[model samples]
Target: MKRLFLVLALLSAGIGFYSCTPEPHFDNVPVITFESISKNTKLDGFGNKTDSLVIAVKFQDGDGDLGVSSTLKEDSLLYKTTYNYQVRTFRQVKGAPVEISQTISNSGNFPRLRDDNKIGPIEGTLSRAILIYPGTVPKNDTLSFKIKIMDRARNVSNEISTTQVVVNQ
Candidate 1:
């Protein structure tokens, strides 16, 4: 009788353990979108140098909730994450083949959304790439660029390549 009772108790415990469901992993990979790119045409028109290219990115996907970090004073449960951005540029030189050249990196952290959190578009910007090439292109020259985004969990989005643009001097 005692052995039978022990067997029933073990079966009950196993059932209870199996019934418990673990919390879902909140670490979600964010989506990356390249909004627009504008170059300094005025400089290109003249013999003057083309300063830099402006690249913008728009992050999406949070059921209408923005991310905000919580501290000792305020605490809430939401999908919190960080963002990483990478930009690379290549100059199409005449004889030399296109080389994987200039690169820039930046990062930002956005905690879970809260009542007081206020931000726009889930977007961020970077523009430190001023002069891609030291010398100016005598004729219309084309250059290539790539954009990449990563989430807090180290998930990287697919690399995006843009159409080659010719810079006329």
Candidate 2:
């Protein structure tokens, strides 16, 4: 009987491939940090009169959104995902560019792990340091940076860096 019709066609193709397999989703991602940036070491820290730049960050979420990236180097700084999610942005490598303002979802009265050290009020969040007085920059140039985090069904986190600002000329 052709081996019982080949075992009933291999159990009807394994029950239609396990009933069209599909099911796997759990959103919860957001954690970022970079608590410092007031650089203006004598107008050579790469700047352009950035209205007093300042950037310091810290985030840990269960919904999604945090980001920063870099390539502005004169010394060293880089990181853009080993894994984690939602939104991340940060850039610099030649002249001017720094604008970070992000807050995505999460009003569950977060911050309960000993307040995770600090920086957590939850009102559009806050943590940054930046000061760009772009008037002088030249010395082994190579700058790059990135910091990102995301959740709220966007899930993304993993990108933290700071390096390549060795302009001690």
Candidate 3:
């Protein structure tokens, strides 16, 4: 009786696991928005020449295929740009902070990847901490940046920008 019960339980568990199917998490492209930004000095090798700037992004995906596999390409979903903080100004609208458009002469990518190369339906805020090296951005400087994400299907997310984030001393 014990053996039969154990066998039945194992079979049921296997069946349950195999029955689940992967479905599209989103109908179109993933949606992303800016959440917050913070400056931390410890992650920059604990040195004065550089610091780490942490950026938070909120995203939602229906299909959950928001990253490239290593077999296909080198880049992942995340990308970014940097700008001088003084280049743009912020406005107060009904006690809300509004971002002003700015043209940046220099821009680059801040690609991020997933460990497994494959992801399921996901909905949450993702945060990335990038090292602000001397050449990337000057220390003790203020800057703004924009970031976006793309899915494996080439669907891109809405771009979000930080009006200003100060690098730590």
**Judged by TM-score, which candidate is best?**
3
Please report the candidate that would top lDDT against the real structure: 3
Which prediction has more favorable TM-score, 2 or 3?
3
- Model 1 TM-score (2 dp): 0.46
Query: Which residues of candidate 2, in runs, are more than 4 Å off?
Result: 1-3, 18-21, 30-140, 151-169
Q: Model 3 off-target regions past 4 Å?
A: 1-26, 43-49, 73-121, 135-139
C-alpha lDDT values of all predictions? 0.51, 0.40, 0.58
Candidate 1 error regions (>4 Å): 1-27, 41-48, 61-83, 93-97, 103-130, 136-139
The sequence of per-residue lDDT tens digits that candidate 1 reaches over residues 63-128 is 324343344123222222234455566667774436454333223343453354442234334332
Deviation in Å, model 3, residue 25 alpha carbon? 7.6
Q: lDDT: which is higher, 2 or 3? A: 3
lDDT by residue (tens digit), candidate 2, 1-169: 9999999999999999998955333224455566554443443345423323334456655322223222223243322222222223334544654534434211111212332333322323444333333433333333334656443234555566544343223
Q: What is the lDDT of residue 84 in candidate 1?
A: 48
Q: 147, model 1: CA deviation in Å? A: 0.7
Summarize candidate 3's per-residue lDDT along 47-158 as a digit string, tens digits. Answer: 4456666777788876666554444433433422221111123334455555444343323332333455545666677676666566544344566666777666667677
